[model samples]
Target: MHVLPERIKSLRNVKGQSQKELGQALGKSREAISKYELGEREPDPDALVLFSKHFNVSSDYMLGITDHIENKAFGKRKPYSPELYAFEKYLKNQDFIPYLQLAVSMKDSHLDINSFKNPINKLIKQGKKQKHPK
Candidate 1:
């Protein structure tokens, strides 16, 4: 669906920016910005990265994966760097079990959208009080 333009405009309004001002931050001409906001043309991946960081939104949010920005996924994660390419190649060569294991390990290292145990959703340490005064 063509949800990006609408959401982008909404985000711009939230930031109190004019199209030209937003374009400057995003390193685009005002006309290009207008076209993107009008849904005349979609932003390319590079521009999408810039938009995500500039707007403090996620690529998923911009792409309309979920309506709530809180559900957004972050990370530029460009798979073009030598390290990234190597990892990508390694992933392509991996068996499913290894991949699953690596993902589980990653959960210990970084929080993710589908990770139920992400600390953001965790209960902090506070003594539980008895409901009926046991």
Candidate 2:
């Protein structure tokens, strides 16, 4: 697994626990703490849960599977909304913007790249015309 050593270390620092203290608290050897912080090995199931609870983060965040760590009780990151994710993906996709522009443009609104009036070019021309009408 692509666990985050630096993230773990950051959490450890936040918790203000020394390696020996944290190892004792987690019921593991000090060397285990070293391994976890070095990214040499991931924590076991029980230890994984313990770490998540200790750091108040999602297991996915601790495992580096997701970049989000939400605290819905406190409204920290809003628990990683799939809708927001979809919208973000759509907004970032280059095709989506031109398609939207093409749909909105009243003057020959066709966004296909091969179209005679490219939607992006049409939008740009419209903007220029609006700004500098003769």
lDDT of 2 by residue, 2-39 (tens): 45677677767756688888888878888999998998
For model 1, where is the 10-residue window of minimal lDDT? 123-132
Best candidate according to lDDT = 2
Q: How high is each candidate's TM-score?
A: 0.51, 0.50
Tell me the tens digit of each residue's lDDT in model 1 across 31-126: 998999889988999999888777666677778875545312443443232234345546676444554675687778885647644442342212
State the C-alpha lDDT per candidate. Answer: 0.68, 0.72
Model 1 RMSD, rounded to 1 decimal: 14.6
Query: Candidate 1, after superposition: displacement of residue 104 in Å?
Result: 49
Off by over 4 Å in 2: 72-75, 78-134
Best by TM-score: 1
Q: What TM-score does model 2 achieve against the real structure? A: 0.50
